[model samples]
Target: MRLLTVSALLLLLLGPGLALQIQCYQCEEMTHDCATPEFIVNCTVNVQDMCQKEVLVKDDGIHYRKSCASSGACLIASSGYQQFCTGKLNSVCITCCNTPLCNGPRQKKRPPASGAAAPNAPRVGLLPLPLLPLLLLSSTLC
Candidate 1:
């Protein structure tokens, strides 16, 4: 009974820190839409906490690379190449986002030309919804 009580207490304390792993659209291609549901993948838990999107404007056509990335690496890459993000010939733009499936597509409205950062999309809540009931039941049984 004491062990069960301790386990339940631990669950209540630590469970909120756990979250569903983020999912992102993952693909590399210029010929097809990589943002489609077919390309979605669950990012590596704990290691990859963000989605990265790279758009390259080439002579032939635009190319896209999408994949899971660590937050530090993604942020550095995106900011380092910010000046080259112009949508012109041979331009390269990289962006990082934390929200699920945020790298999927561009919104219809464009960001301002002044280069100010756009507000981040809302993140998934820290505690997953399904865990609440489990925590409650564990508390009662203990």
Candidate 2:
């Protein structure tokens, strides 16, 4: 009973803080790497809890925009422009994610196995929040 109470108290205090705090790469540039250490920034807590990345293909070169964003706005923009995300001329792709440093470049997907089709949608990596307090409590208790 005592351990349960302590765990609940820790969760109550840390849950929102952990959920709201996020770090992401922030930059706008063309033909340059933006995922360097200097470009990383902490997103505005509670207000901007997601990382957003925009890729625009233009005549000269590709443009990249990485920054913090609110979940609703980022998701709406991503869904609305999904059709125009084709990797052809004038292609514009926007993706959002919830985990730390998620605005960085995407990792190459592994080929499907046994003729399975690959997924089309971008994967949003989410950090498990509820287990955080439990992990902390366990670490301290042990």
Candidate 3:
């Protein structure tokens, strides 16, 4: 019991001095659509800080941000921007971490169908090219 109390007291005394050193990626890379990150840089974080990975999707393009931020900022980053960015943004994802160099790029999540169309998205038209030629030939024969 005495040892437990002593240990707890020591922890209380030393806990305030113990701070974590975090490493994260720092860069702002933009893409027409959400794609793999193309650039990465090393950044050091402050004590009790967190690494932030954010995705900002707009009608024009998608942007990826990785940097160091405080825990409080991480919690309110999204909510704080909701008012002004509500309808402008298609999708937004902000992830926070504390480990060293843990802010590696991740696959960006695309917005719903209301967002930009995919590169290879199938075209929708009156008829298929082959069938259109066949129909034209059949009409000419008739």
Candidate 4:
């Protein structure tokens, strides 16, 4: 298939040791406010290429966590709200990306009752035009 051919070519072009890796700030704690992390370290993601920054909300308060995620994770963070546990539980936000070390700083804030993300929610732009084809080829191989 043409897809297979392109994938093979791209794989060969990438050479060895070019596996996708996502670096993220891995931490979790329950607090009214998440402390601004001073330094970010690499998160070990064996099979997943995506990174995630999530804020889980419950009756107690905010719980912040960040780490790697599977590829099925959205290319961008969703501003929509998802509630569970009889509406007592909520996810303030779940931001995802494929770039290495893309999960940047996170600060805790109460989830809006209206389910809208904060005005400053992170947004990841699409790949450049020239690079898009290469990424597509690489994905086919994988």
Q: Relative to the true structure, how large is the alpha-carbon lDDT of every model?
A: 0.85, 0.85, 0.62, 0.61
Candidate 2 residue-wise lDDT at 118: 52
The residue-by-residue lDDT of candidate 3 on 36-139, one tens digit each, is 34433334334337777777777777777777777888768856655554435676777787766566755477666767677699978785343444455455
Worst 10 residues of 4 by lDDT: 78-87
TM-score of each: 0.67, 0.67, 0.47, 0.44
Which parts of model 4 have CA positions greater than 4 angstroms off?
1-14, 30-39, 44-46, 73-92, 106-142
Q: How do these models rank on TM-score, best leading?
A: 1, 2, 3, 4
Give residue 90's error in model 3 in angstroms: 4.7
Can you write out model 4's per-residue Cα lDDT over 82-109, one digit (the tens) per residue?
3331324664677787776666554377
- For all candidates, the clash counts are 0, 0, 0, 0
Tens digits of lDDT, candidate 1, 40-141: 999998889999999999888889999999999999999999999999998999999999999988779966777665569465566566567666767776
Which pairs clash in model 1? none
Rank order by lDDT, top first? 2, 1, 3, 4
lDDT of 2 at 115: 65
Number of the candidate with higher lDDT, 2 or 4: 2
lDDT of 1 at 47: 88
